[model samples]
Target: MTTSPTAPAYIHVLIVDDHQMVIEGVKTLLQGEADIQVAAQASNGPEALRLLPLYPEISVAILDLNMPQMSGVELSRAIHATYPQIRILALSMFHDYSSVTEVLEAGGSGYLLKNTNKAELCAAIRQVAAGHTFFSQEVGTTLLANLVIPANFDRTRDAHPAELTGREREVLQLIAREYSNSHIAKALFISERTVETHRKNILTKTNSKSVVGLIQYALRYKLIL
Candidate 1:
C-alpha cells in the first residue's frame, strides 16, 4: 500500500496584543507564508495565558508590551516560569536601549518594533525558534552603538523585582486602560468576584486609594504604557 506524503512542519505562533488591527495585520502576514501559521491571537496577557494551553505546538509568542491586562515583561516572566521551552519574541514600540535590554533580560530571544516589515518579522520568528537572537535593524544599530556604556550596563545589572505579583500588575494595567472590573474579569477569563479580589490586593500592595491613584502610581513608576 502507498503511504500519503507528510506535511511539512510549520512554526506555530501566538500573537499577543490588545489591538484588533495589529492582530489582523500580523495574521495576514503570517498566513501567506507556507512554513508558518498564526496559531492563536490574544487580546491581553490573561487571555493569552488561557489560549496558550491549547496550542501545544506553538513555537514562538510575539508579545506586545502595552496590553490592557499584563504588560509584555510580566508575561515573559510568567511564560518562562511556566512553559520554559517556548520561545518569546517581544514585539514592541520600545526599541530604545532600555526597553530592548529589559526584554532580553526578561528571557525574550527576539525583539522587533512595530514598523518592521513582514519578511523581517518572519525571519525573526524562525531565528528565535532556532535559538538565535534577533533584533529589529533600526533597534539593533542603536543597541550596538549603546551597548558599550559602562553606566548603562551597571544599571541593568542592578535591576530588581517590583514588589508586586504578576496578577496585580495585570490588574493595574487594565485600570490604566480604563477597563472596569467586570470588563477586566471578562478579558482575563476570571469572575468579577475574583477580579475584585485582585483589585483590592493591588490597591493594598501599591498603596493606592482608588483606580485613579493606581494609574498615577503605574505611570510614575513607568510600569504601564
Candidate 2:
C-alpha cells in the first residue's frame, strides 16, 4: 500500500493596480484556474508592500505601470529588493519599449499589455512564478519595431553572419520575434538548455550585446524579416 504522489501547490498571486475595477477584473479571470489563487490585492505600491508581510504565500505580483504616487517600476524595484523570491509581472496599457524595459530593469519577470486575454494573463503569471520570463505578442512586436540602428552602423565590423549554422539562424529569428526561451524550445522541439546554448552561440557569433543587438543583427543579415 503506497501513498499517491502529492499534488502541486497552487501559485499564489497578488494583484496591484490603482484602479479597483482592473483588480476585480483580473481576480475574476483568475478565479477559474485550479492551479492559481489570488491571494491578495493592493491599490498602490505602499499598500502592496504593507500587505506583503501578511501574505507570505504570494509567489507572483501583477503590477500596473501607472499609479498615483508610486509607479509600477518603483514598486517593482522595492518589492524585488525586499522580496526577491516574489516574481513580478507587469500589466500595462503602455506597450512602448521604455515602459516595458523600465519594468524589466526594475526586476519584473514578465510584461503584458492591459488588453491581454485571460489565457495569456494566466500563462504569464504561471511562467513568472516558475522563474521564467513572459511577454505578450504585442509587446514583443513593439520591441522589434523599436530597435534602433545607428546611422553609420556597419555590419561588416561585426562578426561574420555566415558563421551561424542553420539551427542558430532559426533561434535568432525566434529571439527577434520575442519568443521566450521556453516557447522557442517548444517550437523547435528541443530542451530549454539547448535553446539557451543556441542563443549564446548566436550572440557570440553575431557579437551582439543584448536582445536588441541580436534583433538588429538579424535584420541587417536578413536572418529574420
Q: Evaluated with lDDT, which candidate comes out highest?
A: 2
Task: After the best TM-score superposition of candidate 2, give how far the Cα of residue 193 lies from its true spot, in angstroms.
Answer: 21
Q: Which residues of candidate 2, in runs, are more than 4 Å off? A: 1-8, 148-225
Which ranges in model 1 have alpha carbons more than 4 Å from their true place? 1-8, 149-225
1-225 per-residue lDDT for model 2 (tens digits): 111112237898999999999999999889879999999999999999999999999989999989988999999999988887788899999888788767766777788988988999988887767655677888777766776655655666644454788788777756654456887887788899999999988877666768756654565566764
Query: Model 2, poorest ten-residue lDDT window?
Result: 1-10
Candidate 1 lDDT over residue span 84-154, tens digit each: 65789998876777777667666676789988888999888887676545677776666555533233233
lDDT of 2: 0.79
Cα-based RMSD of candidate 2:
8.1
**Candidate 2: lDDT of 40?**
94
